[model samples]
Target: MLKEKVYAADGDVHPDQQRIYGRGTELMDAEELVSLHVHDGKCILDLYLRKSKEISVLVIGMHGTRHKVAVDIFSTIKQLKKHLYWENNFCLEGKVLMFNGIHLDDSATFSNYNIDDKSVLYALEIPENHMNIKIRISTRDITSVFLSKSETIKNLKLMIRQHTFIPVDQQELTLHDTVLEDNKTLFEYFQDQEDGQILTLSLIHHIRISLTVCINMFKSSDYVVQSVSLLGSDTIEMLTQIVYQRVFILPKQQQLKKNGQILEHSKTLSKSNLTNGDIIFVDILPLCKITINLGEGHKPITVEILPNDTISEVKDHIQKESGILMNNRCLLHEGAVLEDHKSVDDYDIKDGSILFLSQRPPELVTLTFQRTSGEVSELKFNPRDPVSVQSTIQNIIKGENESASKSHVYECKQF
Candidate 1:
């Protein structure tokens, strides 16, 4: 009797060892033998038998999953040859059962085997198509009017033309490896039959160009432009340019003061240079307070502090106190979820700091009512019946009719 259990390398009485112990029985008589062993922390079975004089078969199966594999076998006289072939070809270093009749190859001295299981039998379940990328383009600020309908490549060229002094002749665009001619326009490149119709515009330049056009052009138009960001290199450059140009402005001279003295004068003084004579007379400006309207039905709360705290930290603190989580829940800061990694610290959060938090809109409910007039009958309603105010009014009207005038009604509610 063979016991079934998961086997490990720590050295235990397992089915694999049992198969090795029963090798003598296989040698005495060529017959199929089924033996189970736990290999590589999985339950597997080995089958050994002589299939033909030229080949012996060794089959292995994993528990639960129906994975069966076959290998070569060798005679006792050619054990050294078998050992050499097994070592160099099969690479079976573990306690695996080697079949006797399975040859390395048909009529060859070697055997071919794979360690695949039943899991490989299943076909991969993949989505047929991915969601199309939705991009919001602002054409209002663009001086280049053609961009409203321009695909990715045209937009990049337009952006490049707007920012850099680089001449169109000096610019070289490449799709994959083939370098596009300097004179070849982006639209022409896509129009050419040689160039693949599917052109990936680089997104790197997208934000930079968008931002540049946005800053330069005064008007704003909402455009659903296809961003070329999916196009690898060009998009990368655009992104890098945008990020590099994002400037962090420090407080202006008028806003920075310390201990009755302007910070500009203390720039040359060390911390230990404190003296009564160093105190300079200065004019004090009244604190400027501006109330931020938090929309139609929201109350604004103020926090008095230096503008050093990040928006994320403030949101976290607000969440901790109000039992409302940010991000997962809604916390409307300036009409949108804080852009990407942008923090509240970017904006000044002084004494009269105002922020808004909004809950998601409730789901809309739909109700439908169907009425039929008939003979005298008793009206009944389900406990879970969802009747609208209008339906209730109609029901009251129907109930007031005579006994001979009866009607049945059906209503449906959807959320």
Candidate 2:
């Protein structure tokens, strides 16, 4: 039978007590210790044990050079010291050995022999199973409304460029890295493209408008002047009123220039020459149909009208017939405000043209009450309370009781 042997660090070989291996052969050499790499579970255990001890010294420095070291014992300190010596050539000198940011020892020497410059050291004692893994998360940017003019596109581009996007050809001037040659509309650039590119362009335009509006307001003191200062229907009405005022107040002027000479004091014209006497005489066509969607309470109605009648007149007639007041209502053409003075002459209201007449939602009156012990403790009604039927009933009962008492008194007097 073969006798087992155990090898010690001192180069002395001893027979194993259990007699597990043959005795004639020496126990596995120190090189064999390299084969016994620490497993994940064993490394974890070692980490816990090492952390349990008082960490008096902590060395934080870049990894110098890493070379494998042969050690009989399995420990982080032994491995690290081996690597440290490997870095500085067997001498532990000129290295910072820190404890809580304070240097403990400048030249702490290791007892282990055969340490080399190529050995790697980690005084922090990271687990051998430690691994670095990377993960990625993706997001999307989208917008619904384009609300700014072309002049503000540069600022808008700066605001949205961080989100990873492409700009339309019309917006090329807006981007610092893009170039433009001739004039091109945004729609032209997006034309003949796949749905994805189209959608991206749409999103970019929408984002541009949003960013421009926001930046302009942030930089300017008159944000309210640019944007209507109300929510929902109020905003629409305010915008319409402003448009009406501008159209009515601003004087129309035409520039008359000849032979590179400017003419001053030109007469004001009500209508542009583009539509003046060049008009083709056409019969006043009837409104194919007028479709009205009032948001709530009534089904959409389609009506016909004569082309000679103005949109405001049509709205007034509709208001009278439908019992809908025009004072609080707005006329919308294709979801935009229909100017009160805009002629319906050139533009015919076709059968399918959607005309939306929106009214401001009615103000809500809240009646709040507090209940205690199955009875209302306090009641508050808005817009003042109405005359109650219960109060009238109580008054009638009191009057009847008074009449009965009087009749009884009369009877008593007669007796």
Question: Who wins the lDDT comparison?
Answer: 2
Question: What residue runs in model 2 are displaced by over 4 Å at the alpha carbon?
Answer: 1-284, 345-348, 360-415
Writing each residue's lDDT as its tens digit, candidate 1 over 1-415 gives: 2222323333354322233224333311111122222234454344342242244333342332222223332233134235435653432232123222111111112211221222121111111221111111121111111121224544445444533323343333455546554444545545443221122332111111111111111124432222222111133233223323442112210222235444342242223232222222222222323233334654554432234345565656565555555654444545665432454456543455555665543333444444344333333443344564456556645655465244434454433
Residue 257 alpha-carbon offset, candidate 2, angstroms: 34
Candidates in order, TM-scores: namely 0.19, 0.19
Q: Candidate 2 lDDT, tens digit per residue, 1-415?
A: 1111223332332321221212233222111211233234352111001111111222345454333444322234434455557763543343323222221211222211112233333333222222111111112222111212221434334333322233332122322224322344333433343321212222212111100111111333433222222211122223234433543311111122223332232321111111111211111123456677766787776666555557787787677667778875777775566666765553556666777787633333433322222322222222332444345333333444343442221111110
- Give the lowest summed-lDDT range of ten residues in model 2: 206-215
Which window of 10 residues has the lowest lDDT sum in candidate 1?
A: 136-145
Query: What TM-score would candidate 2 get against the native?
Result: 0.19
